[model samples]
Target: MTVDVDFHHGDTIDAVFPEADVRVQVGFAAPYAAAVNYGSDPHWPPLTPMVRWTNKLGWENYDLQEADSEDALWQKVDNRRAAGDPLPGAYHLAAHIAENGTKPMLYASDAFIEASQRGEKWLEGRGYDAETPVVEIARDFANWSLELANDNLVSRVSAASDGNLQRSAFPAKVIAK
Candidate 1:
């Protein structure tokens, strides 16, 4: 038996998990607040409501679906905070984010998943255990998604009026690439 794999023709964005759902961590913790206040563009203001709630009531998980854009993500965060839940201090809020930031594994694109499934079939036909290869493929997808997020953060930070290249967590030039 022969299996064919398509990685979506080098379209990394769509290839990762277009059809599958993705959950990302979005927080208004102090570091992120500093990024918004000091690094991001004025037009892209921080979620004031979310910020106020986070500062006073602490943070809560804002679960989002794959279709949700950055704006939609923040809106959900604001909505969740307004609903009122157990509140923590700033330190706790940060700690919670740090601890659970990558939980549930950021989902891979549907295309990536499909390709990996095919890869697994191929491996099976070859009398090999698919588990290792599938896991490796999933790890690659997760890492790629992470890199994209990190680069986007740097780009946003550098775009801010008050943003200084030296202050960026990632090199400003690399993000532009």
Candidate 2:
């Protein structure tokens, strides 16, 4: 489901989403590994069932105060790494946040229909055929937007990152295809 895009008159994404907060990173060579985390900043919430369960196992920073403390926070991070659950560990991170009632979010408009339409129109206006598909970075908002439109943002991101274990961490139910 790859789409080919052609840029005419150098009209870029910034032109299309002007007045929208967007950031683009361009590099000469692709990196060997990749990771991107964009969402609300996470803070430890008041004790919930999940927190209590984790605490029973004696994991550090199980209490909200410990997690909230600057000194204890890094220690908790280190403890997680030692336990093989690393920071930016997408699945664990997402699950933890979901437990606290704060879940990852994808703005429907940004990552779905509107983006696709805007992309197509942008290309068309630049002389590309209306049917020409706009190519986007695999993990980018545009690509995810198109996938989300098809109700596969979770599976797609999960597949690319290894498996759907991280998908389970999302607070929302997986939409059946």
Candidate 3:
């Protein structure tokens, strides 16, 4: 939700060029950005932000479909908290979020998951019973996503060499003049 604050796309830079040393860069000017992305070790964030976030989720999401009744989310938060439900179906999620921070819901997108699965597919194609493992389901899986992407890129280049590099669609004729 916070990646592209104010619709400026100011947080991350995505670019790809062979001549360039790097193709992708993701960072934030705001100091709190990193904390939100990777999460912090169980610390209390300000309650006001938590309250605002709770209220925001309680309202109409427009086109977004929510499983529970939208208007009752905030109303049930206090009760859910009292009952010790950490998430409470997204109702008291803000309270847990304030105290424990959060996993990177956006930092590591589906691309990372696909890349991770690619390895499993490659092994399966070789007749090995391979599994992608449980990294994606782990608590710190977000951090591992980046590592997986890096590993996939390096291995692809090493395995195929320049054969994987982009080639021109048109071919040059070898006919004698």
**TM-score for every candidate vs. truth?**
0.23, 0.22, 0.25
Report the lDDT tens digits of candidate 3 across residue range 1-177: 111111112221211111222212222233443454455666645433344333444532222223444345444555555777554323344456656766543333343556456644543454422232222122123233445433443443224243342211111111111
Q: lDDT by residue for model 2 over 1-177, one digit each (tens)?
A: 222222332355434533333232222111111112224345543233233234433444332342354455545656767888645332244357545534343323334446556655544455543233223321243333444533443443344333422222112211111
Span of ten consecutive residues with least summed lDDT in model 1 = 168-177
Candidate 2 vs. true structure, TM-score: 0.22
Best by TM-score: 3
Global lDDT scores for all candidate models: 0.37, 0.37, 0.36
Model 1, span 16-117: residue lDDT tens = 444422222222223443433333322333343234334333244346433456577566656656887433233243444445442221112322344455
Question: Model 3 reaches what TM-score against the true structure?
Answer: 0.25
In angstroms, give how far residue 60 of model 1 lies from its true place: 34
Q: Between 1 and 3, whose lDDT is larger? A: 1
Question: What TM-score quantifies how close candidate 1 is to the native fold?
Answer: 0.23
Pairs of colliding residues, candidate 3:
none
